[model samples]
Target: MSERYEYQPHRLLRQRVRDIPSGAEGVLMAVITEDVSPNGIPHWVDLAYIRNKSGREFTTAVGNIEPA
Candidate 1:
């Protein structure tokens, strides 16, 4: 079984990408707008649209998010 993470809507979460390039040293502070899960796994939350501090929103896989 794969590990799962639960994120709530309207919550602020610090996110960072795995295996970031050496020159890049930063993480994104975003707010969870919604939860997206294609599979019916109770503890699995797959995707979400997060709005960054700059007000830019993007979609990313849950596995790529590192909790801050």
Candidate 2:
């Protein structure tokens, strides 16, 4: 007998943060953004949050991604 299954979509967000002093080779801290998928359904990125060393935070539609 064959088994049937349901397909569900999902959204994933990955975040990493590090604290660097005058000189460092590795990151101090890393934080991964929580998954915002509801009902375990598939979803797409709508927005994102990012902060820089200057302590300036900003938000934008999910599209731009690069190493800081």
Assess the local accuracy of residue 42 in candidate 2 as a C-alpha lDDT between 0 and 100. Answer: 45
Tell me the tens digit of each residue's lDDT in model 2 across 1-68: 02122222213233432222222122112223334467766444433444545655544433333333
lDDT of 1 at 28: 45
Query: What are the models' TM-scores?
Result: 0.33, 0.30
RMSD of each: 7.8, 11.9
Tens-digit per-residue lDDT, 8-38, candidate 1: 5433245543312222222444434343355
The true-versus-predicted C-alpha distance at residue 19 of model 2, in Å, is: 20
Worst 10 residues of 2 by lDDT: 22-31
Q: Tell me the number of clashing residue pairs for each predicted model.
A: 0, 3
Q: How many backbone clashes does candidate 1 have?
A: 0
| Worst ten in a row by lDDT for model 1 | 17-26
